[model samples]
Target: MRKTLLTAVRDARSGLALRLIAILSIAILPLGLISSYQTSKVLEKNGALSEIALLDRTRQAAAEERALIQSAFGAVEAISAAASIFDSADIDCDAVLSRLITMEPKYIFAGFVDTRGIMTCASNKERANLSETPFFQDQFANPGGLVSVRPMDATTGGIALNVSVPVVVNDDLIGRFWISIPLTLANDLLGESSDTANLLIFDSEGEILATENFGDDRRTILPQDRSLQEIVRGQQRTFRTHNRRGDLRDFAVVSIVDDTVYVLGSWEPRNTGALTGPSERISLYFPVLMWIVGMAVAYIGTNRLVIRHIKRLRQWMRLYSVGQIDFSQARLQSAPEELEAVADAFRAMAQRLSEQERRREEDIEEKTTLLREVHHRVKNNLQLISSIMNILIRNTDSEEAKHLLRRVQDRVMALSAIHRYVYMSPKLSMVRADQLLEDIIRQLVVVGSADEPENKVSMSTRFDPVELSPDQSVPLMLLATEAAINAVKYCAAANGGKPWITLTLQDLGEDHVKLSVENSRSGLAEEQDSDTDHTGTGLGSRLIESFVSQLDGTLEINALPDRFELHVSFVLVKDEGDDAL
Candidate 1:
């Protein structure tokens, strides 16, 4: 019972049941905490919503202010056009001013000022003066040039827009036309659905011109700092500054008429509320409750279902490891989910292993067949070379012909030597080229010098040990055989004595091999360039060139008074019969 319980605990630790419990706890805990936080801050969230809504209302109010300014400027442009006609007309200044004053109620008054800075015509008779007014003084300040617009009061002592244009003819100053329009129509632009918003317009002189409400605190805002007043004078469209109410407010201005910039500003405090603690508490509880229920379900499943099935499956797989295949009684049966599929997978795996064993046997048989065929072909090729050498021997009787046939026979024997080594060993294709060369030289001593010791040539070898594939080994063996025959025949005849032939193989760096043959012979230069018939002109030189060309090697023949040497060097590729291939 104790072992069973321990196994159950181990299964539970590795199983998904405990993992699901952990995931539920992690996923639901943070959500519960966030919901609880929101519940506690419900009132704060509402206040935040209100503040954001007010900021949007402020932006809308600024847009309306710009539209109102655009409309008022249109009216001013129209009035300026009408006043231009008076310069050529035969009319009194007083009559012209009267007609302009009655043209629109939005215009509080209209008049004209002369070159002497005197108001020549009056729409408001009481304040009508030829001089002494700021408007009259500002009008003639530019004299005969473009007149400046001023922000001032209407005749009713309310904020107003003031405009003036110089009456010029042929670049000569005549007088200035002036008009003042009431700013009451501009208040229509300031009205907003949000309660705490207000719009105001200030001029360059730090004076309020048109404002929705001129409370003492807001009116004094321009006097406290030059920033707001500068915004009015310049053409900047959007600005933000602190109002006298100590609230950070955004302001935007638009030109209603020339020189009169209308500004709209609204305030918002940063700490407007969003959510209450109580509302967040309830939101947090739902996810926490779900986590508890999920954990309970997982704990029940760990003990009742997952542990039981997994322990049985583990024992069955352990038995399957030792080649026990009776799974029908020990087979896993569990909930019809991933566990049942895993049991079926185990059965299928066992059957696949059995099928692979049979395939392995068949592969061994096929490889055996291929190895035998390779050996057979190698034997046939060696026999063919032997037959060709014999045929050439029968067709010729000259001492040179006999020597050539003997060299061909030796090369055939060299190939046969490699074939015997491969056939004797277990390996199918490769024979070490060094071992093959040593054996061929040993055999050549017996056959080429069996009759006479006076005609004997001492053979010696020097080479770095290297392996060659059969394809390379065949051509190389033929070249060596030819070089050996040349050393024996030529050097023996000329020296009037037994001579020595040395075979040396050198490895030239990573991808090349060199074969060197040198013989001790006097008058060696005369022999190589001799006009002799079969010995110099026949198959030996051609065979040497063919082997060198086939192996992509360079052959250098050096003849001295006493020594004759031949060197062949070529690229070495990996042997074709390498085991990896």
Candidate 2:
């Protein structure tokens, strides 16, 4: 599997489609990069806008709370100014406070606490010790207008906003005048907002005074790693963080009453525009998608418009190279003009080559037939000459002259045998050296043995297959004939042994061959000495030497008492046609 994948990758790297894809990718790279960068900028801008919008919503939600606090401060100041009137005799402080509460329905309790923490001029009949309470003590120490949240107000008996003001008449400081506003009334005043956001109003101490739209799972909506005090300390107008439940949320903090109260609004991050939410993710991947799409288009276009036709042309050329002469232009018909022209050029070249090959083959056949006829006529003419010599030899009365004529006739027959084999063989240029040598040796032995029928000469021939061009075969055969004839002429039984002649053709490997002709020596010492003299004529020796020179062979002769051996070794000559192939 790994090898298959590697092969596929290697093929892809070499293919035209990959090259085209690379070019297209380079061309589109800048545009893709620019698109991605612009998308990122858009996302950043949308994020800033989202933060601003959240802060605006938080400030808007705290508007009612701001108004209620302002009204409480106004009421406390009005009651403090009226403290001098309460100092006169015959004034009903409780009645005055009750009527005041009746006029302002948002105020649940309105009263004045003296320096000793004695409740007087109260709106309700319930009495509460003022001095021991934290709000009263704080007011006593500070002696200024204050707004405080009470979890369980001593006067109202519920969560309420304690707005207090210092009570003083002229230069004399008396006590504190305070109003209790129920949290339920404050929530009613604030009302509900349109957006699905959780609103929280907390004081400077991080104590949550009022909440709107908060669920029972309040911890889930709040920041997991931070407290309200940390958020107030940071004083960040807007921020983004994951809530306790691991849900991402955007938060906005706005001051409702300058360092005293702050409102925090949290909601799920909103999609400001196109580059937000799911669209933001798409924007981030847009560049990669662009590159992939471009490469795919390029690959498809290149495969269809170019590579397919080129491969078809390649296949056609391969077929033509392997001798498939049939040609067709239809396959490239759908190709572009450039590719079609290339196919046309190749087709024309193939046609010319095919025509030339056909003509050359015809010429070779005609020449081969003419050459074979020439060799056949030459063989017949040489036979006729030998027959004429036979008639001359029979007519002659001198024994020496007849012997010479017969020798000449024997040489003529050897030449005739070479031409006969040439025309009879399938290949005109090359002949099998072993077969030609065997035939020549056998014929020579037969002629020599016939001269003395009583001398029983056993001739054995061994030929190994070897091929040579006609030029080499002719000389090789002539040399073998001369050597075999000499061997046969002197062959005799040694010491009551039967006379024998052995002719051998051996392939010595590496384009070399050896021919051997050996015959048993005559038993008589005088006859063996005469055998070394080559039939008392130097003509046979000269002829053998000339034939050996023509064959470019090295000749060796060994005359032992038992036998005479002649061996020739030569490099086989290869045909020109075989070399070309």
What do the candidate models score in CA lDDT, each in turn? 0.63, 0.78
Indicate the residue-level lDDT of 471 in model 1. Answer: 67
Per-residue lDDT over 149-233 for candidate 2, one digit per residue giving the tens place of the 0 to 100 score: 7644657876677888888877777888888888766655445653567777776667776675333664466777788899888
lDDT of 1 at 197: 58
Model 2 steric clash pairs: none
Best by lDDT: 2
Which RMSD values do the candidates have, in order? Answer: 17.0, 11.8
Model 1, global lDDT: 0.63
lDDT of 1 by residue, 1-581 (tens): 99999998997687777787777778777866776667546544664564455445555666755554455445445545555565565855566566656876556766656677555566664334456666666656644223223444434364455655666656677676666655555545455523565666554444565556544555643322346566655654444556655556554444443554445454443333322234434444655666777789877877566767776777877887886765654455555578788877877776787577568758765775676667667777887888887788778778688765776688777767767656554555455667777777777766667535567677788767776666677788778877776666665534676577788877778868898878777773465544212236666777888888888888887777777878889887665544543
Which stretch of 10 consecutive residues in model 2 shows the poorest summed lDDT?
528-537
- Flag regions of model 1 displaced more than 4 Å: 1-402, 492-498, 507-511, 528-537, 574-581
Off by over 4 Å in 2: 1-15, 28-293, 326-331, 396-403, 523-537, 575-581
Number of colliding residue pairs in model 2: 0
